[model samples]
Target: MLQRPPAEPGMREDEVDTPALILDLDAFEVNLDAMAARLAPTGAKLRAHAKTHKSPVIAGLQRRRGAVGQCVQKVGEAEILAWGGVDDILVSNEVVSPLKLRRLAALNALARVQVCCDAPEAVPLLEEAAAAAGHRLGVLVEIDVGAGRCGVAPGPEAVALAERIAASPHLRFGGLQAYHGGAQHRRRPEERRAAIGGAAEAVRRTLEQLRQRGLDCPIVGGAGTGTFELELETGLWTEIQAGSYVFMDADYGRNEEAPGFRQSLFVLSQVMSAPRGTGRAVLDAGHKALPTDSGLPLVWGRPGLRYVGATDEHGALAVEDAAVPALGEKMRLVPGHCDPTVDRYDWYVGVRGGRVECLWPVAARGAMA
Candidate 1:
């Protein structure tokens, strides 16, 4: 069930309910504009990953700022965006399920959709779905560009898969999905640069093979917030798939010289307890509200207040030089990982200048397939 609006327009940020997903509107807009300006020169459109914000409202904001399209990891997310009027989308991941491919292929009536394929066997299944729908499906060959998660090995192996995809009358060779997800949070700038450098070289070789095979690779897609600049430098990528730039999660902020994005997404929590003599305070928001896979959320703007641990319903703060937070005191927490933390909420309490400006649903929350 959907909860009531955490705070109405004109209400103070502190007036919002505890554990609310509050967006710092000013900071959020700045991050969006900064990304638009940063990528405007490179000619690579921001295929902003919807797995992060998961809101078509946010997608519309990005579209208004010049994003070419959105990228999703699942069919459910794609359906939410397409229903919400996102015309162009890429799965950016493989969809090997027969039923899921049919559902994805069905969206062709409403939007321009594409999916990534890394194996030859997946091609025939995609072909069946497209033939059933009587529409051509755009398929991107996902090359394993350092991220060993999901992708075909770059070079002849990837080229061979592309051949299989291009041979299918129902499928169109879209491009490559070369995102280095693990490199995004690498602490050092040099480490990130080196990681993307290797990925780019791999992409370069795959493109060469595609050229030799006489395949028309319309789009070469990939690049996250950490190494988007590096991808742009190579001039090999045609689409930049950055999603976290909209919400600077704590993990990304820890990067040395993190891509000049502000901390815009925060979980508004309140101090539920603080013993008079104790050196610790407990926040109402914990594991359920914030994902700690990346690390603990940071208490925003609180110098000595550290969020040390989290349980199901409470967050433990180790107070030091900072004063113990009083009961009912509201605070903002910079999430350790923005994407999953976003999945915990039903709505975003948009706040600016200490007042609530608007409320937007987390429309695609839990859109996992």
Candidate 2:
């Protein structure tokens, strides 16, 4: 069930309810502008992934800043974006289910929809769906590119899959989905450089084979906020599929070289319990609110106070240099992982200049297939 707005326009940030998803409007817009400026000099265009924000409203903002399209991880997310008036969407991940493929293919009338396929066997299922829908769907060949997740090997295997997609009467070759997800979080700059360098070589080999086969791969899409600079330097990927640039998290901050975007998204929690002499306080956000899979949430803007642990419904804060937070004191928390943490909330309380400005729904919140 969707929750009511935790805050309204003109309300002070402190007056907003606890455990709400907060967006610092200024920082968010700055991040958007920064990404646009960063990519303007490069050949790549932004295909901001909807799997991050899950809001078509945010997608629209990205489009206004000159994003080419949006990419999603699930068919439901594509439906949400298409129905919400986003005209272009790519399911960067593969969809093998005939049922899901049919639904995605049917959206072609409303938008330019695409999906990835690493296996040749999945081509027939996709063809059937596109044939039934009477719409030609775009299919990208997903090469492993060092992620070791969902993709075929780069050279002949990848070209073979692309050929399979091209030969299908109902499917057109889109390009390559070569995202190195694991490389994005690598701590050191050299580590990231080396990882993306290998990925670029793999993509180069695959592209060469595609050209030799007379296949025209129009789009090469992949890059996250962490390693987008490296991908941009290559001039290989035509579409940059970065999502987290708009909402920086603690995990991204830990990278040695730093992701250039500002921290904008936060879980607005309050000190619910603070007993005298305890040297700690409990917050209203925890496992159910700020996920710790990427590491514990950071205490934003509060010096010497650390978010050390969490339970089901509570976050333990070690209070040291900073005075104990009074009960009902609202604070912003930078979640460890922005993507999953976003799914935990139904609405984003947009704040600017310490006051509420707008409330946008987490429209595609649980779009898991």
Candidate 3:
């Protein structure tokens, strides 16, 4: 069930209900423009990962700014984006279930949809579903470019999978999915460079192998916000899937030389308790409202304040100064991880100049199939 919206237009920011998902519209627009401008010179297009924003409203905004389309992780998310009028989308992960493949194939009537496959056996299952739907499904061979996750090994292994996808009567072999997910959070610039360097080499060798097999690889899609520049330098990755650049989190911000993006997403929590002289305060938002996987949320713009810990319903704030936040004082928290933190919200309370401007539904939130 959808909960009541936390705030309405014309309301002051402080008037919003506690524990709301807040978006700084000014910063968000800047981030959007900055990302487009940065990628424009590289000749690579943006296929902004919708797995982070999960909203077609944001996707539309991104498209207006030159994004080719959106990238998602699940069939359900693709369904949401397609139903919401996003014409092009890529399920940038492997899908195996027969029922899910059928659903994916059915979406061809509404949008141009693509999915990744790492195994040759999965190709026929996908072929059968696409044939039943009477459409050719676009398939990318995901190469394990150091992120030992759901991708086939580079070179011969990846070429073999691509050959299977190309031979399928109902599948169109789209290029490689060589995203280095683990490298996106490497704290040092050199570390990220090395990681992406290895990934690029693997992609290079795989492309060569695909060519030698008489196969044409059209798109080399990969790269997140952290290492997009490096991938761009390699002149290999054609589609940049940098999602968190629009709403940077504490985890991304921790990088020594992080990408030039502002912190646009926040969890708005109100102070519910402040024991006298305890140097601590309690916030209404906690584990249930914010993600802690990357680490605790940062107290936005509060230099001396720290989010020490969180329970299910409360967050412990460590007050560095003697001035503890008064009761009902509103605080904005920059989430540790933007992706999962975004999944916890139902609506994005877009604020501009400290006033509520708009509310956009998290259309694909929890769309985990």
Candidate 4:
């Protein structure tokens, strides 16, 4: 069930409800414009991943600033974006279930839908679903460019998969899905560069083989916020699937030379407990409100405050300063993982100049199917 808007328009930031998802509108718009300016020099286009923001409002904002489309990890996310009036969407991951494939095919009537596949056996099932739905769905061959997760080997094996996709009458051979998700968080710049270099080499070799078979790739999609600049320099990745650049997290901020973007998302938690002798402050947000997958959330702009631990509904903060956060005082927490943290809330309270400016729904929050 959706919750009521935590803050109404024109309300002060401190007046908003606790454990609310907050968006710094000024910083967010700056990030958006910064991303567009950064990508304008490179020939590559932005296909901002919806798996991070999960809001069609953000999608439209990105598209209006020059994003070609949006990318999602599931068919349900694709459906949500399509229904929300996003005309172009790609399920950057594989879908093997017949019901999911049918749903993806049916979405082609509403928007341009695409999905990735790694095995030849998956082609026939996708084709059958598309044929039944009377729509030609787009398919991309996912190459294992050092991610070692969900892609086929890059050379001849990828070419074989592309060949199979092209042979299917109901499917269109879109391009390659060569995302190196693991490399996106390598703390060192040299490590990230090496990882993306190897990935680009594999993709280059695979593209050569596809060319030998008279196949042309329209899109070579891959790259996340941490490694997008490196991938852009390679000139191999045509479409950047970066999402976190819009709302950075503590994990991405840990990179040696972090992506050029400010932190725009935060969990506005209020101090519910202030134990003077123990030097501890308890917040209303914890594991349930903010995800700790990447690391503990950071106390934004609070130098002496440290988020030490968390429970289901409470987060314990260690106070190193003499001035402890009083009860009813709001604190901004930069989440460790922005993606899952965004999934916990249904509405985003857009704040500008310390006042609520608007509210946007997290339309695809739990669209994990």
RMSD, one per candidate, in order = 0.9, 0.8, 0.8, 0.8
Off by over 4 Å in 2: none
Predicted candidate 2 versus true structure: per-residue lDDT over 1-369, tens digit per residue: 678888888999999998999999999999999999999988999999889999999999999999999999999999999999999999999999999998898898889999999998899999999999998899999999998899999999999899888889988999999999999999999999999999999999999999999999899999999999999999999999999999989999999989988999999999999888989999999989988889999998899899999999999999988889888888899999999999889999999999999999999988897
Query: Model 3 Cα displacement at 283 (Å)?
Result: 0.3
CA lDDT, candidate 4, residue 11: 98
Candidate 3, residues 307-351: lDDT per residue as tens digits? 999899999999986478899999899999999989988999999
- How well does candidate 1 score on lDDT at residue 56? 97
Between which residue pairs do clashes occur in model 1? none
Can you write out model 4's per-residue Cα lDDT over 248-350, one digit (the tens) per residue? 9999999999888999999999999998678889999999998888999999988899899989999999988647889888989999999999999999999
The list of candidate 4 runs beyond 4 A from truth reads none
Model 1 Cα lDDT, one tens digit per residue, 33-100: 99899889886888999999999999999999999999999999999999999999999999999999
lDDT score, residue 48, model 3? 98
Output the lDDT of residue 338, model 1. 95
Error of 4 at 140 (Å): 0.4
lDDT of 4 at 46: 99
